[model samples]
Target: MEKSKIWVFVSVLCAMFVLVACAPGSGGSPTPTPLPPVSSYEKSIFTVEEGPIVEEKQLMGEIVPSRQEELFFRASGFVTRVSVKQGDVVKKGTVLAEMQVDDLLNQLQQARIDLEVAQANLAKDKAQREYDIQKATAEVTIWKMRVADAQLDYDRAVGIQKEKALLNLNIAKENLALAEAALKLVQENTNPYMEQAVKRSQLAVERLEGLLAERQIVAPFDCVVLRAIIRPGQQVDAFFVVFVVGDPSELIVRSPYDFDLASKMTDKIEVNLYFDSKDEKGYTVSYLPNFLPVTTNKEATTTRSSGDYFYFSLPKEIQQQDLKVGRTVFLKVILGRKEKALLLPPSAIREYKGLRFVIVQDGEKRRRVEVNEIGLKGTDKWEIVADLKPGDKVVGP
Candidate 1:
């Protein structure tokens, strides 16, 4: 019986060893153990505070003159002369450039000569008509005197001599009548065809002069040539810009009109401008209203309503800076501001689905508080309206 018991114990020991060999620690995959719960305090935490919330918008702009002229040619031709170059100070009506207009000049001269000839021909006709009328009048008077003499002779003579005198008197009367008719014709006649010729020639001269003017570019105002686009012998098309001139003494910053900025503008709003070539120091500028007249060129002085650009007048000192036209600039405007508001970092706010909330700490407990409204979102912080106070602590997502 002792021997049988020893064998059963050995078998049990062997089975136990086999079961241990088949266990997970020996060959099968081990089960994972769960980690401890993480505390909300371990994550990022922020405390709401009362501070000024300012909303600023930045836009790219360009420096420009307050009033400028874009000079262009009305007719296309090869540029024959460029009298002024860039930065040339000039007076009004100063010729800046000219196109190939030798033909135009020759045509204009011919038209002027033609006009002179037409005028001379008209004058000559007038003088000749007067002389002819005078000559005809004199002939009529002489014939009348001869008729009177013949009539006297006819009345004093016998039969044959009376007949001869009557015949002479009749002949003299006919001559006098012919001379009077000639004088009437001369006095009543008008050389309308000659007068029309004179008018036509004058119009041709004026037309040529106008065409000649189109081939030249003249300064419209006293200005400095900001840019000279046409070089000598450059071919250009009609209405092509040849020069950009402006009063450099008066400069302004211009940009594309922003509808978003326009909607936020108020009477008390301020504008700040930063030039790319300069430091971060901002310059204050005044916004020009659309109703104000802005002279663009000599032909017209238009208002801002006629253009799609924004204008801001700079301080005189700022205008004196070495800023070039079309230089890139940055503009900043404070759209809204609140002096004492509940401000928090954007990261502290949490959004799930469509609801925005924040994890607020209440003493020893944390609770989710819904953000009722967000106002004046700034660069680094957000103005939040919630049930929590300014001193509340919030956990980040």
Candidate 2:
């Protein structure tokens, strides 16, 4: 029995030691559970290539005339006549439209008649003055002749005859003096007021004529009428546009100036233009920096500048029938180009905190290589200047 008790006590003591060893914080430190192996993250990859890269800019523009004008009436009135229609070829000074001018015409005619009458009256007055002077001069000559005759008679007569001849000579002398005085008065006559009246009538006629002109719309140059906004009996305000005229012989394409694109453009750069209405492929042409004059439209006249446009000429093969003002056009311009350059897909480039880099794959490892400079960026690929070579693999962002 004691031997059994000793065996039981030893078994109990061994169990207590095993419990103490298994309890939390009993040992110096426990071994951590091993983590599962991390799987590698895979991403889309691209290979760098050596090829020519070109960067281009696309623009939407319109076909416009190199020279154009908007015709309007300077004075307000009811429209009485429309002399031209759209697409009518006209010469300079061709009347495009007319406004209510019956009253102005009457006034102009009356003023012209008044001017003629004033001129005639001035001429008549001058003629009358000249006639009076001539008559007085004739009278003076007659009296002097009579005086000479009387003196001769006196030389041939005795005392009584001599006294009568002297009396006659004195009478003739007095008459001649009176005639001379009359002639002087007539010669001194000057009617400046009459000339002034004629001038005033002429000015009135000119003023009326000017007002009549303002009531009509006239072409400023030989051009095709693109639009006529007035019709018979239509009332319009002053400075309202009544026609749109342009020289169709010389056509040009114009676009709103893009400062950013302008800065990148060069004289040697070629432009491709596509007519939207015709759905034609395009014409390769050159571009020029131009200043389009501001339109007479009140809205544009206030805020637009001449430098807000770029001009391009159409190809010679383009027919006038295929073009129209305000027609939409598409333009593609080559902004930059490079030959035999290191090219990479734009997706492969990564940016972080202002740092541009690419994940370059070498064997089984991947590392980031900083992109020092980028050049001639294209739509799909970009030219990257980095520590990379052709056939190098890069991971896409």
Candidate 3:
């Protein structure tokens, strides 16, 4: 019984030792002392900078060709030849179709003949006038000779005392005056009726020739035929747009812009363009004459721009192929620009109730700086023309 008691006491002691070894903070790898939490506050040192920052405005625009003119022949006739149908690509000055112009050709031929006749008549009329003037001059000379004879006869009458010679001299003087008057009238009065007739004939010829040419439809430029409105044997009216021609090589970009900004826009504003891909320096901005509706972003802080669409022809590419028409692109226009100015990232800026402030770390003490936004570095950076120095690290994206 004593031996059993000793074994029981030893077992109890071992049980207590095991409990103490396994208890928390008692032995091996004592509950790893909890580490102090790391601070999550990020830091952004700032420095004053003098650099160029462009005030960029990003807007969407569509690519389009420079010209998309409707093809038409300002003549009414039956379509006899359809040289080019829809979807045919053609060179500049290509004949797209021809109209039945047999009647017009006949009319043109007749007009030419009539013009020749009128020209001949005008020449004959002018010759007739010259002949009349010459005949009148000759008659005046003959009358003068007659007047001299009569005068001589009258003088002889004075010697002979004859009344018949005096009366004949008086008649000769009257005839000479009549001939002079007739010559003066012919010289002063010229007939232009034949010249007017010639002009009328010339105009008729032009009209007929133009009508004959109008029978054919020609492509105005290097274009892709988009549509053929008239078919063979179809009669078209004058000034009918029978074909649609579009040139892809000529291109432009049309987009909506902010109204207030555009109101101050000049035709000489600088432009930077961006395509769908992230490639830069492909195209420069150009000022377009036409305006469009304002572009808006519902999610933007400033939702709407000034109400005006911008139109600019796409500049020639640098070893690049033609841009696709009707494709969407991002256009960045520099509304405002500043050279060599201090800049800060948008993160440094914190907006309050209608006020903008930045938290500047100055010599270990956080200080709030009120800065005037003078310009824009980019979409998120601001170029400030304020009292700031270089070496100020700005901690923001």
Candidate 4:
């Protein structure tokens, strides 16, 4: 039985040895444990370089003429004549429309007649005043002579005759004093009430003249007549816009921007204007030009809570192109630009402890080099200023 148990143990040891031989690490040199796939990681890299780059911003806006205005009237009246029509090119001070001035003319005529009548009445009043003054002077002279005569009689007579004469002379002296006062009052005989009436009549005539002058709508600048809203015999109220004029020589794009954008923008900004007329596939590129902001009147803008007026001149680059008064345009404003700058993909840059760095790759090795200054070239790129020379391979962050 012991010999049988030994044989069984030998058999089991042989089976264990065979199992160990089929295992993965049971070879002579141990098959050299395949090294965890070389511990590799993929990283993206970028080559630093200097080139021209523009930071462009796309904005949609409409086209407008540089000098455009709507002709308006101050007083309500009927349109008597339409001197010009749509698409009529007119010069500055050209009469475009005329309002009915018949009423104004009649009123002016009445004012003139009233003024003439007032002048006649004033002449008659002056004549009457002069006659009163001359008559009062003569009466005062007669009364003074009578006083002298009474004084002579009083001096010459004696007793009762002298008393009677003295009484008569006293009455005459009172009459003389009254006549002198009347003469003094009539000496300065210009009636203040009549003078005021004459002035009022004159002002009426002047005011009517001014109103009559405003009866015609004239062009303020050399422009094309874009529209004439009023026809012959059409009634319009005060400040009603009757004509639309556009000076297309210096075309522009007028758009409204809030105070925030206007405050932060540079004075001269570059723009790309896309023409609205496209042949179905859509426009690929557009005209480029620099624009200046239109000035806003602070006093006129009572509230900045709403939008403010802003405009951009139609790029001089497009001056040779055919355009209309209300042509549609799109603007691509260049917010920033860098000429010959080292631009790198944002992914190639790494941030550590508030410092911006780029990882440079040398074959299979990479190291982070701190950058002195970095600016945003675009949404997905950065303008880096560092010791890294151009064409340096930058690795992924």
Best by lDDT: 2
* Most TM-score-accurate candidate: 2
For all candidates in order, the CA lDDT equals 0.82, 0.83, 0.72, 0.73
Q: Any residue pairs clashing in model 4, and if so which?
A: 44-396
Query: How many pairs of residues collide in each model?
Result: 0, 0, 15, 1
C-alpha TM-score for every candidate: 0.59, 0.63, 0.46, 0.44
Q: By summed lDDT, which 10 consecutive residues of candidate 3 come out lowest? A: 293-302
Candidate 1 per-residue C-alpha lDDT over 168-194 given as tens digits, one digit per residue, 9 for 90 to 100:
989989988999999899999989989
> Measured by TM-score, how close is model 3 to the native structure?
0.46
- Report residue 161 deviation for candidate 1 (angstroms): 33
lDDT (10s digit) by residue, model 3, range 1-397: 9999999999999999999888887756745688999855565555556677778667788775555666666677778888887667899878888888778788888889988999999898788878889999998999999989988877777555568888888888898899999999988877678888889999999988777667777777788776677778888776666776678776677776667567656778777677764766547867775543222323223222224467776666633454666668887777777777777776676778877766666667766666666466577677765556666654442
Off by over 4 Å in 2: 1-44, 76-87, 120-188, 226-237, 240-244, 249-251, 265-290, 295-303, 313-330, 350-356
Candidate 2 structure quality by residue, lDDT tens digits, 1-397: 9999999999999999999999999978999999998755454788999999999888888877777777778887788899888878889888788887888899998999999999999999999988998998998899889888888887888878889988888888898889889889889988999999999999999899899888888888888887777789888887766677888767788887888887766657888898763555778877865446335476222334556777777888877787877688888888878888999988889999999999989998989899999998899999999999999999888
**Order of models, best TM-score first:** 2, 1, 3, 4
